[model samples]
Target: MKKLQILAGLYLLCSSSTWAVEPVVSAANIQEIRLSLDSVWVVLGGILVFFMQAGFALIESGSVRSKNTINVLMKNYMDACLGGLVFWLIGFGLMFGVNQTGWIGTSYFAPNEMDGWHWNLLFFQMMFAATATTIASGAMAERIHFVAYIVSAAVVSGLIYPIFGAWAWGSLFDGEGWLKALGFIDFAGSTVVHSIGGWVALAGIIVLGPRLGRFGRNGQVHYLAGHNLPLVALGGFILWLAWFGFNAASTVKAEVSIGRIALNTHLAACASAVVYMVYTLIRGKAILMRGTINASLGGLVAITAGCATMSPLFAVMSGAFAGILVSILPVLMEKLRLDDVVDAVTVHGFCGAWGTLAAGLFFEGRMFNSEIIAVQILGIMAAFIWGFGVAFIVFKVLDKVLGGLRVSKQHEQRGLDYTEHAELSYPEFQHDVTFETDDMTKRH
Candidate 1:
């Protein structure tokens, strides 16, 4: 009887101790029911952002002279491929690896925490990184040599972006630093992605200088046109469709607001397209085909900073204004000695800055934290200062080493499609069409 009582007491004590303990998990097990749905949505949305590369490729090829079409396509493809490896090596780790303190990340580059619960969300982020770097290519097209471009693209994807990203998204850095204390919110990277790309474009343009005959000796502007307009329009349409994914996916999870975000994106894009087409009709004799397409893109960039915060009405207004700005800014840039071959700065940088500020002005409080606007502004400055500063230094160094970023003026007149590349974009047309017809048939 004594032994039996002792054993029973011991069992009770052990059972009670075991019951008091609860299992702990490291991160939120978003691997579960509701989060699973959210995961699917985010991953799919990211895929759409990836598809924008095709849109970018089409737009670039169509906007440039025919001889440079294949070259542009090649550059786009290589950016994705090279950018992917760069992301895996250290970029993702730097961006997401550290704790919440916020200055920079400390850990996440490996494959273990890299693959589950997402289509590799890290991988999806990598695609965005690539797109940002690639945007500079079009703006600097027909002038930059291929080897110089490869180095620039690799450096951007590998180092320039990730470091700044850590400041915005790194919990460790943001938590401990000025950025977090100031309540900086960049929900989808208005300045981080678009502005960085714009700054790089600016650097390249400054370093490359004007294309041959782009400016007369008297300082007036000259036209060195594109090869195809229809293709550019088609590319623009594809980008319009894809932006839905870019802005929406930044949520990182499906929530009640995803629907609102999608709506805002669509409305802004629609408003931009209409407003630009109208502006073109009023200004130019016929539709300035490419300008309207670029204007639509500007609206999309402007909306990215606050798709979730602003009303659909504000989105429309924001987009319309951005469209006008994009449609008109290129002439101003030319006047100022900046050569943006595809106007990447206006579409990405200028519109991006405007969109971020719009969030401060128009965000609906009940829908979003009012603090987001201030945060967005801070983010824009951060992106611009860092992006422009770093690129300026890089381009200056490259210019010193490589004798400027542009091909020789002789190469420009001969056509990069035939001279630098030594491959004819249209040998048959060159043989059959008179110079006038060739110029008329071209999209530029």
Candidate 2:
């Protein structure tokens, strides 16, 4: 009986010890929990950013003539599809790969043994790559051949975009980069993504030239209005909604910083919109709807590079500055006879540059840093040179290889909807229509 009692006591003691230890083991690991939350937050943000493609499609299609609506939609769709496939295949490797000489990435191709966390990072970045490529679609719309656009999308996502991205944002996870060392801080890629995309768009529009009838023989510029204001407004709203994710979620972790970033983004966008409206009204002109939308977008772009670094007041100032640029830059481009279909250059390129500089100047408490601004300018110049210069050569080569980047005169007149795709956006309406000479519209 004594032996039996002793054995039972030993078993009971061992069971209690095991039960006590299990709770300690299961106690929340703060680091692991934080990482998991970050992953979920970033992935959700990526989905929101992904939806911006729809917004782009609506914006471009609504802005262009109805005859070319289907063509613009296809280009937007292709931007996402081609960007995803190519970025997964090579861009991710190039952007976040092992650093080689601090210029570009060298690793992360599919089928490799990568951590799950790295894959999550890649998914988030793929959306950014797609967005960079899609921005050019609006500028090059109505004129670019489908095949040529495909090539452009592939090259931008696979090479041009990734290479520049590596220069600035490659160190997001690990490894040092030259740009970061030079104190070029783009918190969320105003120059890295927007400027690069904008420069590429600029190159494309320059190469493709103004759409037919956009300018007259006497050097008069004509206005080409979008087909639907309501659709344009919808697109703008969608973009504004997604931008919260774009800026706040860029924090990569659920923290107090996210709220600040969100607030800054919202304030900047609102300030830009209100300022643009007032600016236009003061110029003895009615509030321009397109100007308002572009101003909001420009403000968002402006804040992206500095969203994390700037306070809300500074963010508003940056956005207001961007709003001014958005309102005036397009007009200046038109005066120069440079036709940008949707002011992609003004909103993304110019405002993106300003935003980068603003971040350097208004870096929270720092207020003024000449060194930082110099670095910012260096980044901006590099982006323009690399993005615009490479795209120019690529488009030039593609033009020769594909016979031309622009559609035949006949196709442009008839509209790319019928020429590029046999389907029409509104098949019920007569497809055999041409733009009205008095107004930029199609009539049977």
- Model 2 poorest 10 in a row by lDDT: 435-444
Best by TM-score: 2
State candidate 2's TM-score.
0.91
Query: What value does the lDDT take at residue 290 in candidate 2?
Result: 84
Best by lDDT: 2
Q: Determine the backbone clash count of candidate 2.
A: 1
Model 2 accuracy (lDDT, Cα) = 0.87
Model 1 C-alpha lDDT per residue in residues 1-444, reported as the tens digit of each score: 999999999889978966676657535653576678877877787788888889999999998877677678777888888887887787777766654556566676654543465344776688788878898989888778777887788878877777777776554222333464575555576667887889888888987887776888898888778888888998998998888889888888777788999898888877887898888778864667787788888889888887987889999998999988987889899998787878999999889888877876786763345566667677788878888888888877877788766677665655566554545567777543223334433533
How much is the lDDT of residue 19 in candidate 2? 53
Instruction: Estimate every model's Cα lDDT from 0 to 1.
Output: 0.77, 0.87
Model 1 TM-score (2 dp):
0.84
